[model samples]
Target: MENSLNSIFISLYAQRIQVLFAVIGVTITCLVLYCYRKRKPGICGNLRFSKVAYNSITVDWDRACYTTHYRVFLRKPLEGEKWRSFKTKNDTCSFTIKNLPINTNFVFSVCACNGTVQGPLCKESEVISTQNLAFKMKGISILREETLPNYIPVYDVPFRVERNGQLKVRKVTIGDYPKGGAHQVKSILFVSIPHSGHTTHLQGVMNFIFGVSTKDDFRLGFSSDITKKSDEYKNWATVYQFVEYEGGRLDKPLTLVDIPRMHGPKKEQLMMIHEQLKYILELYEQRLDCICFVGPANSNNLSPEEIDFLESIMYLFPNDQSSDLSTDISCFFTFADAGPACLENGLKSSSVKNFKSYFVNWSAFFRETNEFSDSFWNMNIKSLDNFFNHLNASKPKTLRLTLEGEPPAPQKKENVWKLQPEVKEDVANLQMTKTNGENFIDNKTKLTYNLQFFVYNGGNQTN
Candidate 1:
């Protein structure tokens, strides 16, 4: 009996050992399959063009499965030619190739990537040609309407003047007197950061000048249809156009809509803003004839970095405050209170008081009239005047425009398209130097790059 019991126990132990071995064999097989099985990122699909601009083309593609990112290759079709590789984040489906040589053809291809390893080169590719449309061809001319409306449009009247060698604000006035009166006005946009009282002060100016209280009668928002609202609002609606930005808001300012979400230091944020501003200016270039930049004195609470950024913008577009009649855009730097008290105390006490010496001799545009107290409009006009002096010194030669009230002259559209003179230099560098096979800049590098191209061009290049 004891021998039979021992035999049973041995049989059970052997069975258990065999089952454990079987489980281990299955696990090992799975592990081997997972390691060696094809781990390629999904194949790239149709590459298409979303937009073709004067010096750039926006390329888009269908996202590949399991792709951590996409690698872009630019090739100038030739025998045994290698592609110029670029890259975009996995979530980014489109990339804009900027600073491209005009009137040239290039083939573009995309491949999926898994971490550092890229999948097979996409079989599908797209052929694109860059063209300088702004320079090569004339845009369709828009006709101005001949029939005149009965009401005097606010925009018809220019509110810019050269005062004591500074660019100063003029009272918002009618361009002409109404013969059979009951005037009409067109749309106007008040561009400024919030809490500087630009809206409230502009309201006072409009009411005093127009002789009717339309303080609450304006539309608020950015719109492509400023001309459409002329008939609806008659004339007063134009003076009430105020688009608000920044003031106790955690969200981004409306002016920063074109900029991408940013990380890193404050300087990075300013740089991105600068780029987006350039893009915005490009989009509205042709339509900027009547545009104005109105910045109030109290809004001068700009940080040193912010001041530098603004100064760069002024250098890029010095004609922002051009008083020329044929000017495409004008910049208006105003005081918080346009009265006498603010004028004296302003230059001496404002946040920009220390830096007010920069704008000394430019035109001084004021906001106060007889209806409002000169004391009520307390602003640092002198400091602002000095500020314009500095602007005059740093202003670039290429950006200068013929002053308004002076003769109209031919100006190059290229200047508007090119934000800075260095763009050409950067492009020339890219073409002159041949990239070795390791031209691909890894996504991890915390480097600033141009919007259209991924290559580093020394310091940060504006859009």
Candidate 2:
């Protein structure tokens, strides 16, 4: 009887264990099914910027099937601050947020919501700001001005430096624009001290103003054949005529012919340079309207000898020329006399008393940060813009003509023509001209000329 009782107990225990396992497996299956039925959907994708302005930006994202609405979040990345959020209707995927700060960087993200349920935030977001908008638009106007024949180079840069310590200069005839034109062109030359980064900075300023790189800007084709062919100066010669000095010092006069000799020239050699430079400037003055001299701050301060050289060139070249040559042949002057390379207080050149001089600060771009501080690149851009505008400054005049979007009602009487109001077409037309207006057609631009004022502040030109 004792053995049979023990067997029964063991069998019962085994049966109980089997039942427990079966129940546990069934419970696990039910739990998994319940979780699957209530899973959350994913967030939207393809977030982008549709439009950007000085005070507003329009952002959009891809639509999600389960989403009934979307939430947009924005904040300035540089300023570690709380995010500002907004909502958009389910049917609407784009939101034009307004009343934002100017020149401030912002990052945007979006999240999707399905009535009571919300999905995860978008994996990608757009970073944008309403800065440089005006600069971009202003570049189009400058591009239009550049199309006129006068704005084109009247003479090619004299010589191009070669990599193998050779100078390549060919005698190519640069032709003038047709006899008659609506506007006069002004020519300017920019020369810099060695290793000042002036060339690079000037190129950057041009790119910023025109809103284009060398490859994209159509005007780059107007560069001289030597400039386009020269690897050492292809980009520098694109916008302005770049002149480089090979000699150790500029305290004495020099010319392209004298640049081959790296050693210091004696007094007799200096006299020869003076004569040759005078002759070259005379030739250049016939075509050039103004000449800009820039000395970028470098490791070495501007030596007294260099200052003497610059002064001699500035005063001696333009003013000491034969007075009876031509009444309109004087070259207006502008100089960046001081920079990080030299910390001199002021410049006094007996030859040029009224020219413009700027003490440009040193600012560089950092690739690791992918940005320039507020006082750096942006400051450079502003300073350059101001300087260029000053070069072409003209008083603004009021026009009675209305843009395409305005009502058809006539404004006050003015000499301006009654323009047809077609905002969309006009804007598109302007953009097209800015991109492709390098050709001179009958000495004038094919694009419509909207601005009424043309200022020639740099040089003198008489018809």
Cα distance off (Å), candidate 1, residue 206: 43
The deviation in Å at residue 63 for candidate 1 is: 1.7
Q: In order, what lDDT does every prediction score? A: 0.41, 0.44
Candidate 1 stretches greater than 4 Å from native: 1-38, 124-126, 133-463
Residue 64 shift from truth in candidate 1, angstroms: 1.3
lDDT of 1 at 147: 20
Task: Tell me how many clashing residue pairs each candidate has.
Answer: 44, 6
- What is candidate 1's lDDT per residue for 162-224, written digit by digit as tens? 211121111222222334543222222233332334443343333232222112222111122
| Cα lDDT over the full model 2 | 0.44
Per residue, candidate 2 scores C-alpha lDDT tens digits across 310-355 of 4433332333344211111111112232342222222221222344
Q: How displaced is residue 439 in candidate 1, in Å?
A: 87
Alpha carbon lDDT of residue 121, candidate 1? Answer: 77
What residue runs in model 2 are displaced by over 4 Å at the alpha carbon? Answer: 1-186, 212-285, 298-301, 315-346, 349-353, 359-363, 366-372, 393-463
